[model samples]
Target chain A: MAAWGQRLAGVRGVLLDISGVLFDGAEGSGVPIAGSVEAVARLKRSRLKVRFCTNESQKSLGDLVELLQQLGFDISEGEVTAPAPATCLILKERGLRPYLLISDGIRSEFDQIDTSNPNCVVIADAGESFSYQNMNKAFQVLMELENPVLISLGKGRYYKETSGLMLDVGAYVKALEYACGIEAEVVGKPSPEYFKSALQEMGLEAHQAIMIGDDIVGDVGGAQRCGMRALQVRTGKFRKISPEFTASPPLFC
Target chain B: MAAWGQRLAGVRGVLLDISGVLFDGAEGSGVPIAGSVEAVARLKRSRLKVRFCTNESQKSLGDLVELLQQLGFDISEGEVTAPAPATCLILKERGLRPYLLISDGIRSEFDQIDTSNPNCVVIADAGESFSYQNMNKAFQVLMELENPVLISLGKGRYYKETSGLMLDVGAYVKALEYACGIEAEVVGKPSPEYFKSALQEMGLEAHQAIMIGDDIVGDVGGAQRCGMRALQVRTGKFRKISPEFTASPPLFC
Candidate 1:
């Protein structure tokens, strides 16, 4: 057997990052990576349970799944564990109303939550809506509350797009954190709870699952911290080998 | 003599913060603080030289001086040391053209500098202009450079206005810094060079001057760090007593 195949012998389940692993794009369009569609199908054909874990907050899960399907990927909304749905669940569980600073495309995801007289600030990839007015409004809402709550969807610094690299939600989250002198509660990617939830959905232990992703920090490092074996791919935002990744280089790439 | 009087016995010059000390307002109008205008005249009557050192980047020095003069302050444009004018001088000295991310009110301050093809990013209190497009543009410019340079007008987290406390340039600067993985060069308050320049203009050393302002960090702490005796005021953004101010409470509050 190959080195990768030998390593995956004991893995019962797999968590895959969608953006850089399956496909990479901005807006509603995505160009599937070469052989990625077949790769995902092949993984599903095997006995291993599969889950798509993504930190994408710009689109609704349904919209994202539809986009993936359009590109001939065998994916479903139920199998995708994204940040928006996780954030919505967290809001519902805590009974917290959020003043959302997110993109227009994902607004429907939070339609069920009460937003009037918001007690907390929920920030995501706002895209062009990350204006001074919106940010200031979110800041004011947090400052007015006795105990300020800022919930960030994801904490990626920047993401690649067709145009170029663009600022992400984490950068704006840091801005609010600095201005209000408070740390934000992140709900996606490297959050231990997020990773654990995905594992629980698969009905598998952390050690039983393996993660394949392009993001070093959010995916590989996050899954590794959760006791899962992780593999990095050099397709998307992988610039160079970081200190943390030096020990375990990308096996598949 | 009293404790404060004894402390000020050797002080040859006074560096006064304009916004919170003399008046406080938002937009174009300002309401002068009670007895502040008369206090300025009285200070000038004494032997101590006085200079208005401000981090007000939303407006030009001419406009700021005009507003102060309208409020019965015995002041001129030359006696005021503001961030915008100082930043322009720095850009010229370094021979770096900047893509300005500042408010429209202060745009004229950088008229002399070449901005055709920017080599650095200059950020300030952009007010409503801190949009996603503008910030992303600045980020792209910085990322494209071999060595990114971000020059900030002031590093204030938040400032007070008639409406409420609003986010300042420092918060946005932090956003850019985190996104680009680079530290910004602050050209305003708390910067040793800015303070020294104010002192040099007034023909006084750091030890021979006293700083009186409302902001604990920007005005009091910054001046203190530059070896000057600093006093805090209980106006504007001053909240509870911080650890750094425990030993030196606001003498004039």
Candidate 2:
């Protein structure tokens, strides 16, 4: 831990991804399947930013924070961001009653659906319940309407499990538009709003924080494009971004 | 338009992006913007699947198809799909009622909000009506309750408009989860279910079809990983993925 901490000497804070960087995206089991817990604990003890963001829309920050605490790290919900809650914020801010366009796992977010006007917010996620019909409706909303906005553009890759496979919202957004005639305006990931939001929350300028993640777009490239130094990890599905990266690449793998 | 179309010839099908690809994210502009209609027409005459997909949550397939036809493209509504419609199919199939979500322009799709249970499905699309009050209720349903599902893992980039910068559903998804404890289950891009669904819809075997898009994980890499030939466009971000395909230091780029 000391040696690893020293590697990030000048780095003010570290933006870590939960699944691949900290935990191994597993539930009903343990925190990690490898040495990730100890590694994360070491990072936290070193007093880094330890901010975790993920394209994963499965667990809430609170849920993840509790799970992480049990695993070994002391963290709070403030250090995380998932897709579900993000969409809700936009809908609430707009004051529109939206019909949920998502799976059974995420239906609890919107308790009320207003019908004064047909204008509503559309939230897309990666879940088991995503089907053609849902996509059809999403397409309808994106294409037919004159002013539709997309929340994020972080592309999700398929995370294979033993039972079957599921989609992340990235694909759903693309597919919906293909089926519909509208195009959604994305707000997350490579978008500056998300980066600024993170910086604003941490009380640091973009130059003050170091972004880290398993993905090329969200972690490495996204940060670099937004004026932050990035440290790519070998954890989670990190290999997909840089498949050629073996034991290490130019920088810390 | 003619020159670009000529360059796009060998590509067989053009999997155009909905946001900046066609009308430049114009909502309710009334008619197609000049060459957009002509470009699409030439592509359609060339027997291409001028397939369109967007991250916008504003319109419907029927409307888009009608609009495209009005703009002079040989298109049909059956070929479209949006997040709202997709969510509808998933929820209705399993006999589940979902909490509705919407963005600025996609409120029309959720004229019917199904909430028969405490499990809320958070659907997010880009529209003028999405607001903060909506986020509050969604947060309550998700955080207050245990394991409440929040759907709508949105995707797409942000569009700069005259009024201001607008967000898509994907970004909204992230905000919702940031406020609440529950996470959204994503169901787009690189999700095998969606890939399979597309293949099934075409009545073509996975091996026989080729998927094309600009994103790596969602288009090229996603499809390739799922056992399909993939071609990624040079445009958009992630240029590092296929940087200067003219040479090769790595096998998989």
TM-score top scorer: 1
- State in Å the error of residue B208, model 1: 1.7
DockQ of 1: 0.82
Backbone clashes in model 1, listed as residue pairs: none
Q: What is the TM-score of chain B alone in each candidate?
A: 0.94, 0.70
Q: Say what the RMSD of model 1 is.
A: 2.5
lDDT accuracy of residue A161 in candidate 1 = 72
Kindly list the per-residue Cα lDDT of model 1 for residues B1-253, writing each as its tens digit. Answer: 5986888878999999987788886778888877788889999999999999999989988988888888889999889888887788888999899999988999999889999888999999998999999999999999888788999998988877878878989999999998888999998898988899999999998999999987778888899999999988776666653323444454333
Off by over 4 Å in 1: A5-9, A240-253, B241-253
Where model 2 places Cα greater than 4 Å from the true spot, the runs are A1-9, A26-33, A111-121, A160-166, A240-253, B1-253
Docking outcome class, model 2? incorrect
lDDT of 2: 0.53
lDDT by residue for model 2 (A61-179), tens:
45657877887776777776555566667667887555455544445544454534546435545354344334434444453345655454355533322222223455555544433
DockQ for every model comes to: 0.82, 0.03
lDDT of 1 by residue, A149-252 (tens): 99999898887776677898889998999988889999999888989999999999999999888777788888899999888887656555232334445423
